[model samples]
Target: MLPEKTDTVVVGGGQAGLAMSEHLGNCGIPHVVLERARVAERWRSERWDSLVANGPAWHDRFPSMAFADTAPDAFATKHSVASYFEDFARQIDAPVHCGTEVRKVRRVEGGTGFRVETSKGTIEAQNIVAATGPFQKPVIPPVLPELAGLTQMHSSAYRNPDQLAPGAVLVVGAGSSGTQIASELQRAGRRVYLSVGPHDRPPRSYRGRDFCWWLGVLGKWESKTPPVGKAHVTIAVSGANGGETVDFRRLAAAGITLVGRTQGYDNGVLRFNADLVANIAAGDANYLSLLQEADDYALREGLDLPAESAAHVIPSDPGCLTDPILSLDLAEAGITTVIWATGFAQDFSWLQVDTFGPDGKPQHDCGVATAPGVYFIGLPWLSMRGSAFIWGVWVDARHVAQHIAARHSQATG
Candidate 1:
């Protein structure tokens, strides 16, 4: 049964929600976290078996608990990440209602607070903190609505190469997920075809230190300046296989066929626009911009940083750059599996608040939601670029909890 009322109701048990709960408890605030599944369920079920965190273990710590026993250089696997969150919830004694899925969060009668309807029961709260995470839903394009007699799945549903049938595979969207999946398939001796797009290609490690270290030292991680809407695409950083870079060039070298960006389907044939070279060049430009910013910061701060490394440009390959592939017959190429690595879409269908903007994102000055008594955490560029990451959730979570506490004081005072 639900409590009569709580000071705050956190609607997730992932990194963001757990961190928020920790801070609320620290302040002696009465709150509860409602989770649809066990803590870190996405890491346990949605992710692939061999998937690893994009950053190192050192960067994945919660404020109350650090992975002191684990090596800082180690990249946490899917299982390890899930275990870490479970242990965190237990160690902190987090009040999480697992297996309780929230169906709707509408304002209570008279606008006093919120009524959170869940599978178990209805919960009333003076404030709500939506920490449902950024990756809400997997996005599949409209082109392949029905692929006859072919197996198609999003990267979130994909497990391993052995699950696919014996045939060539086409992986769409050359972001981190697409590239990584394609690389894995090629390594397993499967013919892989990767569609390219405009993406950031930053090196995993640079100049004897991880790229994240430089970001921290250069004040990139702490900056609260949010990007102008979703137009800004984040670089797909990877710490897979001991911090190796995963880009189109790397995949191409590993014998993965590189094609242009997928446009649409035309009469049972896959269509690709001729923008491969342009997309690759744009990615290289973004990589250079990041390096340049870091170099300028080092110089301005009089830091003893190493000289900038030479750029790793994609070699001119006729098959990838010059030759244009307008269309392809799936049956002719013997392509049996198509993996959609096209990223995720957010769904706030249960939230009955009017604080969202035209982009369907919560319009808030930092974590404070436009709707009074409601807050948010784990949003990209919410307080900073790192706000959505593991360690980065601490600041936003603490801020939201403090906001709730101050409001409670005013209400009771």
Candidate 2:
């Protein structure tokens, strides 16, 4: 295969990018997958050891290959999931140009194609697919000021419980990652403090079934639509409050104390809103009640639902905490480690393309870009839900690859 222009270029060779590459490879199309790092770089580099996917093991498996047949119930470790991607790439012989960081992807004149400028060299393609994932950037809040001089770190920077302080630790964020990390730190014998934030709290299981099984049925595992769009209620709220999900149970079992509320930052002490926990808990209860109504409606309509579902059990309030403003109290409290289990952001400065909208996100639907032949896949909430998930990306990838193939045939003719 001589080096030259190809039909399409898929950017960011993670699971989604590789899935596209695999489809293109089988079709015998001329293509190249440019990866800024080795395959599954984010999972290998960012995620911590104690971090298992919030979703179950079966739900976590990617497209084209299943995770180890042995461990199907439990979630796959980051390393294991990474290896699965590596094996998938090797098996399909995907044309992955590793270590090739893309500088910019500009749509060339006359709509002929795109010029993908990379660290290695320049390459032109009739189409470009930005499979660059949402995990491209770490979203550390500006609220945690730099002048505080506390030992601060994002969850991405954290690897294990030992990395936190041996004494008391403060985890600011009550999301799945935040809750889990806080529990781990407590188990490691470090007195832990948590500043919960706005989030949905779900249990690990309901009626002996994994929580994700409920999500799949209730349209979360493979969310047919966006989260806020589906339910007027939040059935997943709790700490022995309503439903049975992992975060609530694990944190409770760990004996992690719930700081009632945080108002603001003072001289050195963290303040709390008087109604912070109460209000959030109340709101979540109302939300869960709405879910209950929906569930009852479904059942009354003769919807013979699975025995174990999110609706079967009620969840308790996974209380909201005060906003963490690391003034001086952090050091005063002997808080050594700060695990920020916040969510993710995207960084597309490297590749300059119209594919990105005002928010700097890829301007594509599913994998279809506004510009002809310029495509993208594996974006957060892309074309409904599950677009970023391992098994789901391929659904969009197959369609994009077919489009790529058609373009190839047209060009050849």
Best by lDDT: 1
* Candidate 2: residue 200 Cα off by (Å): 1.9
Summarize candidate 2's per-residue lDDT along 1-413 as a digit string, tens digits: 21457778889889888888888887778888888889989888887775555565576665457776326666666777788888888888888898989888787778688888888888888878878876777876765455555677888888887665465777766765676677667777877777654555554554444555655666654555655533322233222212234344336446665553344554556654454455356545544654564466457766654544555444454432434233336666687656666667777676665566777667766677776777778875676566777777887788888888888888888
Model 1 Cα RMSD, Å?
2.0
Question: For every model shown, what is its TM-score relative to the native structure?
Answer: 0.94, 0.82
Pairs of residues clashing in candidate 1: none
Q: After superposition, how far is residue 72 of candidate 1 from its true place, in Å?
A: 0.4
**Regions of model 2 farther than 4 Å from truth:** 109-111, 220-224, 227-244, 247-253, 260-266, 272-275, 278-328
lDDT of 1 by residue, 1-413 (tens): 56968989999999999999899998888999999999999999998878988888888787567664568888888888888999999998999999999999999988699999999999899999989998999988877757356788999999999999999999998777788788889999999888887777776776566788878987778877744542555466677777786567667777888888888876668889888888878787767777777777777888776774564344556565667577888889889999999889878888899999999988888889899988989988888878998988988888888888899889989
Alpha carbon lDDT at 290, candidate 2? 42
Which predicted model would earn the best TM-score? 1
Q: Assess the local accuracy of residue 282 in candidate 1 as a C-alpha lDDT between 0 and 100.
A: 78
lDDT score for residue 66 of model 2:
75
